[model samples]
Target: MLIDASSVAASADEIRAGAVSGIIFDMDGTIIDSMPSHAQSWVAFVQNHGIDIDVPDLMRRTTGRTGAECMRELFARDMSDEEAWQHIAEKEQLYRELFAPIFTEVAGFKAFAAQTRARGLKVGVGTAGDRHNIAFAFGHLKLPTPPDAVAGGDEGLAGKPEPAIFLEVARRMAVPPERCIVFEDAPFGIEAARRAGMRAVAICTSHDAAQLAGPHVLAAARNYHELIESKFLERLHVEPA
Candidate 1:
C-alpha cells in the first residue's frame, strides 16, 4: 500500500481549478473495508451449496456487477428477477454476517468526507450493492454525514462499466457529469466514471492502481489516509462552504 504521494498530487490538475462540484463514491472497497468479507462469503456460499467454483475468478467476474447480473453470470443462466433475488439474498445475508464484526471504513474516510463537504462538494454514493447491502453498511458505518444521494444496484439499473448507476447518482445530485469526480475501487467502477463523462480517483483497495487507471483518473491512493496526507482536498480549489 505504498502510494506515490507526489505522483498522486501532480494528477489533480482537473480539481485545482474548482470545476468539480460533486463527488460520487463506490461503496464496498472504496468506502468500507468489506471486500475481503464479501470474498469470504462467496467462498462459504459456494461451499455450503456444494458447488465447485474458483472463488477468485468469481470475484473478478462479479465484483462490480448487479445482483441479478452476478447470478446470471455465475450460473450462466437467464434468471427471472425473482429467482435472482432468492439466490442472491441468501448470499448477501452471509456477507453481512461475516462482515458485521469487522465493519469498518477505509482509513480516514469519515474525516475526508467531512472535509470534502466542508469545501462545498456535494457527496453521493453510487454502488453496485443492493438496497439491503446499503442499509446494512450504513447501519454499521454510522457516518457523521450521510451522502447527499445514494443509488444502488436494486434500482433496476445496469451496474458498473455501463455508467447508468453513476449517471443516476449525478442526476440526483444535480451535477453535470463533467463536473463530478467519482471515487472508485474496481476497474469497472473506474471505467463507468469515464463513460459517464466524469473523472475519477482510484481507491486501491481490492485491485491494483494500474488495473483501475485510465485517462480520466486523477489520483490513486491506498486509503483516505493517504489522500489526506497528500493534501487531496486542500489542493482542490472549491467553493466556500
Candidate 2:
C-alpha cells in the first residue's frame, strides 16, 4: 500500500510495537552533500563527449536516476543498452574523482545515524548511485557499520520514483516496507518512499526550504540536525496516549 497521511498514522502503531526495525537513507543529497559534485561531473563528462548541456538542467535530469538513465535522456539519440552503460560508467568514474576530496556529511548526519543504530534501528542505504559511487561513499565517510544493507542503482532494482530500491533495502534488512522510514532529499525519492509504503522525511540539503515542501514528504528540514530537533523522529513512535 502507498504511504499516505492515513497510512503513516497506521504505521506509527508498528513503530511503537518495535516491529519497525529499519531506517533507510538516500546517499547523495540526503546523507552527504555530493549533489553539486555530481552536477559538476555531469557537465564535464558531457562536455568531453562534445555535448554542451546546462549543468542545472543535467542535474535535474539525473537527480534521482542512474547515470545510464541520465545519459539516455541527454543523448536523445537511440543507443544500445550496452553503449549507454559504457558511457555512464565513464561518467561515474569522473564523478568519483571529482567528489573524492569533499566527502563531507550533511550536518549532524553521522551522529544521527550512529544514534539511530544505538537505538536499535537497522540502518540501510538506498541510493541511485552505482557500485562505484557506493564504494566511494563508504571509503570516504568511514562509518562503523557501513550500512546494515545497501541497494544501489545498478542492482537490477528499479530506480527512484519507483519505490523498488527502498523496498529492496527493507527486504534485505529483513524489515517490512511499511515499517521502513525513508530519509530523502529529492522529489523523486519522496515519491518512491510513498510508493513503497514508507513514511519519508525530506532533507533539504541541496534545495531551498520552499522547494522541498510537498505532499510526498511528511516533514522537511534543512539538514539532519533540524530533522532530529524537529521531533520528526517521534514519527518512529506511536502517538502518546
Candidate 3:
C-alpha cells in the first residue's frame, strides 16, 4: 500500500522490528559530492562553445538531467544534433578529469551501503548520467561490484520526473515499485520516485533540506550518518548490518 509520511514515519519502528527489501540510489548528488564538478564542467563547455548561461541558470536546467538532455536544452535549437552530442561528450570527458581526484564517497554513504547489502537488501543505481559517470561513481568509490543493476542516460530511459529510470532499477532488482525506497537530493528525482510509486528520502548533500521538501520524501537528512543514526533505514525495516 502507498504509505503516507506519518504512516511511513511510524512504520520505521515496524521496519526496525522488520518490511522493505531494497534501495534505489541516485548517483551524483545523492551518493557522492559530484554536482559542483558537473556544474564547473558544464560552464566551461558552454563558455568554450560560445553559449551564454550562468551557473544558477544551468543548475535549474541541468541538475537531475542526463548530459544528453542538458545538451538538448542548451543546443537544441542552436546546434545540429551531431554537434549537440559532441558537445555533451566533450563536456563529460572534461568533467571526468576534473572530478577524478575530488571524487569521494559521501559521508556515511559507503558504510550505509555496505550495511544495506549485509542485510541482504538489493541495491540499484538510477542516474541521469552517462556510462562514463557510472564508471566514475563505482570506480572512484571502489565499490566491490557495480550496483546490481544501473539505469543510465545512454540506456534510453526517460530522465528524471519521468519515472523510467527508477522503474528500470526496480525491475532489474526484481523488487516491486511500492516495496522499494529511493534516496535522492534533487526535487526532480524525488518526483520521479513518487511517479514510480516508491517512497523517497532526501539528502542535503547539494541543496538545502528546506528546498527539497515534499510529501513523497519520508525524511530528509544532511548526510548518511544522520540518516543512519536517525533510524531512517531502520524505520524502513532494513536490518542492521
What TM-score should be assigned to candidate 2? 0.86
Q: Using alpha carbons, what is the TM-score of model 3?
A: 0.88
**lDDT per residue as tens, model 2, 1-241:** 1123342233544435434577899999898888888888887887898987777876766688865677678898778768888998888888888888777888889988987877778889999998888888888888877888899988767677889999999888888887787988887888889899887777777765445444445556667676566444565653211
Better of 1 and 3 by lDDT: 1
The order of the candidates by lDDT, greatest first, is 1, 3, 2
Model 3 lDDT per residue over 1-101, tens place:
12224433445444443256678999988898888888888788878889877767867766777666788787656665467667778998988888898
Scored against the true structure, residue 79 in model 3 reaches a CA lDDT of 66
Q: Relative to the unseen true structure, what is the C-alpha lDDT of residue 13 in candidate 1, on a scale of 0 to 100?
A: 61
Please provide, for model 1 over 1-241, each residue's C-alpha lDDT reduced to its tens digit, 9 standing for 90 to 100: 3376555665456557547789999999999999999999898888887889999998888888899999888788899999998888999999999999888999889889998998899999999999999999898889878899999998999988899999999999988888888999998899899999998999998988789878788889999988888788877756432
| Of candidates 2 and 1, the better by lDDT | 1
Give all TM-scores, in the order shown: 0.95, 0.86, 0.88
Quality of model 3 by C-alpha lDDT? 0.78
The count of backbone overlaps in candidate 3 is 2
The best candidate in terms of TM-score: 1
Question: Any runs in candidate 3 off by more than 4 Å, and if so which?
Answer: 1-18, 76-82, 238-241
Cα deviation in Å at residue 74, candidate 2? 1.1
